[model samples]
Target: MCFKHDRAVGPLIEFFPRYCIMPAQIISGSETAKAIREEIAAEVARLKTAHGLVPGLVTILVGEDPASQSYVAAKNKTAHALGIHSEQVTLPAATSEAELLGIVADYNRNPAIHGILVQLPLPRHIDEAKVLFAIDPDKDVDGFHPVNVGKMMLGERCFLPCTPHGILELLQRSGTETSGAEVVVVGRSNIVGKPIANLMLQKRAGGNATVTICHTRTRDMAFHTRRADILIVAAGVAKMIKGDQIKEGAVIIDVGVNRIGQTESGKALLAGDVDFDSVVGKAGAITPVPGGVGPMTITMLMKNTLQAAKQAAGIE
Candidate 1:
């Protein structure tokens, strides 16, 4: 039985009969995200009433990629729902790099727009690095700016990359202990892996863990994985980690979201890096694919935007 953290429960042992295996506790990202959104909504209300400040977020989409369009739309809708001044700029595929940079500059200078996010995977002609560098670090709520990245490395107070930040939130809210724990992250991507590894090693409330990151070249992936007290898998492959690779009672945070196949009605079937069925039985707590880290990523972006707005208005 996948026990949700929010529901009332008696003794944990009572739910499992003698000789029967107990399923991993389900760390519901959807429920956690909802609770965080409520907190943010309350804070937004207070910020408006006390200081007359409303958070503002602007998301820029360079092309007509279906996935990017949908992601940007969801962000705008969430911003509006939270009483933020949300703006969506949809440019043609042929939009010049110079023109895009100019738009970012405009938002950077505009005091009303506290957060600016440029959707990733720009068109072939555009230099992705140059576009990211053009964004003012203070307004880069997506936390992709070099300045923000550097500050994050130094453990300074800067907007963290949303997905990694969300992972930390999940660990924190789920009551998973990180201090001195063995954390093995199975990817080195900048967005998720590197940042998360850095976060896990930092001397903070959600950190102070011994972290090891595995990548494509790792010779013995299972060896390292088996040693982990908490395993974080972000490799894009579907169901890569199996039951035998993890330590017993390890906390599993699966970050991979792959479209494996479609359902009978034509909906996409999603899967994570860690094989859910095989690992769920051994894990002490685990996050499910669809309702896991995905929702928390957008929620953290909203959090960063709110923080940016507060900083701009000189309101702590």
Candidate 2:
């Protein structure tokens, strides 16, 4: 059921009773992330001029996994383009957990490297947790360190997990008010779901929303989703949330990137968790799959690296 406007969004509607279909405004993460990168570039230039410090980032990849290599390469490219000193360390699949930990320790003590990121999905023999825990919290720009997680929970100053922070940036940059909004996040992954939910519940500019997280255990998913003013879907399933499942004008942020098929030329066709075509006409605003949350993740990691550099130089 549609409701008439109670707030001053614009002039009153002149439509017939009971229904109106307005297409959702597309929230382009590519555009937003580009704008942010420009801003980071300027700050990087200034940091060099005044403080004579170059923000440095180092990414460690454990294996030759094609997808991981692609992601790491993209990150290195972006960091270089943004004027941040970037390095990528590649190791064989047979590299032991202890060796990886030792490498992390070397960077942790190296003042030249402000941010250290270990590309995930280490070899089966390597203990991923041990490697992650070995990096110093200050240099843990991926924000997966236990110390950083604890600080985030307390609302203290720390590097936030990249994807979650990116989602917040997308919402705030799009001028979506969250102070009293009803936000329903679908997923429970430590990477996206848990952190994003906590961020929206904090008492801050991009936070203070009433957040409800739905997981596999959720009895009535539609019941919670239909009531959300802002719906963030990261369940990892392809086109899981359909049009009729959402409220009339809810803002949708799709974090899932599933390859449902391939195009004629062999390019992969991607879709978000929220079915874009099904939800477009009813949603107030929505993000597209491949271009939505995907671009912002690495950008936020760059942001964290810059912040880490500033902190190391004692420059706020």
Candidate 3:
């Protein structure tokens, strides 16, 4: 069956199997973001009232990349809204490697700092892997530390990267089944690609999905995507996959964040890897950029922070 959301010019058609037609929640990004913030706020209040513990997050931004600044700002705003203590350490683009390491060391030793995230795409001068390694694994909210990554790979309970965890939460909360399904993840970046692929293949609840990972090096991406029961695209390209590339009744999870110029206004707008207009008519369900994966990332970050706080307090 097809679902249409009418617009001024025409109806936006989306298809799903007839049995799957129970009015699916739109999963509004704004609404979910607000609810997650409120939930974290309540949890923080409870923790403080019972244990006098306040969750703390520290973010280090090395350069003034516009996108990085905006992302850090949003993180700060959300932390405050949730009554969690947060601090941002801004450094010059030319800051020395030793200086960055020193900042991480300080946060590492600070008992109050429950979580730490060094913003991505650090200045070209600094070694990104070295900085990530310097973060104490316990406080690595971004989950980029080798320790956490290793733990995840080994199927141990640990803080997971926000984006991947968010995608999992989105699928679960939406009532999508993953067990034993054919899941194709397009992209192999350590952050969103590899970790997610590992998570899906784990032998656990909400996992055990047969996963295929595709990358630029893959011979035929469309062939893999077309057969996916759940297709996750994180290739960092704009509308790289069209409707015909996906199979009917497949669930599409877009992890790419691309800025493309608008045709009419010539201004830039955000888009995902999958062509939403085209694939919506073929996929069983699809996540829209700006709303789908973005909000979940922040929510999962809060969750990791809360977990860290609990660990620090010996409550978990």
Candidate 4:
């Protein structure tokens, strides 16, 4: 029952020393999404009246990954619904790195466009890191650029990554108490795992939580997960964690988006890292996959776009 390192032992002992199931709230994203849209619409209206121009979000899609295409399409549709102008630049799968970088540069310089996001998981032939670095930090609404990442790490003011930021929003809107809680983030990716951990452990709002991050190499993942008051799974595995793995009453945030085998009709189904049906009864709170973290991601993008606009226009 002891971890090798004292840093690990300290938190493990101080928090999650006992396992007990707590009452959970299953938050559907529809209500959250509707409220977010209304808030963003109000913000947009205020910005337009104050600055005389609306914020614009430009998304660059290089290839035709069905999932990525659908995501971008949804983003565009959501932007319009929220009264934010959206522009998408679609390029062939064969588009070179230079071509993609050039497009990002154009968006960076365009005064009318306040935010620029390059759809992720670029073709294998392209260097995603190089392409991401080329985007100006001011216009990097996706917050993947190293500059923004560093800023977030240092606890400085900067654009937070969409998914992590969305997770914070979800927890906040749900009235979850982050301070003094034991939060286990089950991923190490810069996008969700690291950023979220940083956010939860910060000294400000949504911070002050003790955080532990587990990954493929981590020993006894369940041991750590069951101890967490707030369990965030982003491992990209389908139903990898089961209800028995979590303590009763633990708050679960499923960030995984995995497409499993087709149904009897040959249509694929989506699932989260946690087994929803199994965990629902035991968890005090849990987020469903398709409607949970997914929708919040795009909503955060809209927020970042509006922030980028205000920053670029010196409107605070």
Model 2, 1-316: lDDT tens per residue?
Answer: 4444556532345453335566798999999999999999999999999989999999999889998999999999999999999988999998888888888888998898999999998999998888888888998899999999888888889999999999999999999988999999999999999999999999852689999999999998999999999999999999999999999889999999998999999999888999899999989999998889999999999999999999998898
Q: Looking at model 2, report the run of 10 residues with the lowest lDDT sum.
A: 9-18
Per TM-score, the best of the predicted structures is 2
Could you tell me every candidate's TM-score relative to the true structure? 0.94, 0.95, 0.90, 0.90
Candidate 1 per-residue lDDT over residues 1-316, each given as its tens digit: 5344344743444565443467999999999999999999999999999998989999999989999998999999888888888998999999999999999999989989999999988999999989989988989898888999999999999999999999999999999999999999999998999999999999852689999999999999999999999999999999999999999999999999999999999999999998999999889999999999999999999999999999988888
lDDT of each: 0.92, 0.92, 0.86, 0.88
User: In candidate 4, residue 247 scores what lDDT?
Assistant: 83
Question: In terms of TM-score, how similar is model 4 to the real structure?
Answer: 0.90
RMSD of each: 3.5, 2.7, 5.1, 7.5
Better structure of 3 and 4 per lDDT: 4
**Which digits, one per residue and each the tens of the lDDT, describe model 3 over residues 1-316?**
4444457313334333343433323435556666667877898999999999999999899888998999999999888888899999999999999999999999999998999999989988889999999999999988889999999999888899999998887778777889999999999999999999999999752678999999989998889999999999999999999988998878889988898866686866899998888887567888888788898888889889999999988896
Which residue ranges in model 1 land beyond 4 Å of their true spot? 1-18
Which pairs clash (backbone N, Cα, C closer than 3 Å) in model 4? 21-248, 21-249, 22-248, 22-249, 23-284, 24-284, 24-285, 25-284
Identify the superior model by TM-score, candidate 2 or candidate 3.
2
Candidate 4 residues lying further than 4 Å off, grouped into runs, are: 1-23, 264-267
lDDT pick, better of 2 and 4: 2
Q: What does candidate 4's lDDT look like per residue over 1-316, in tens digits?
A: 4343266566765575454233358876657877988999999999878778799999999889998999999999999988898999999999998889888888888998988889989999999999999989998889899999999888888889999998888888998888999999999998899899989998763678999999999999999999999999999999999988998889999999898877999877889999998999789899987889888889989999999888888887
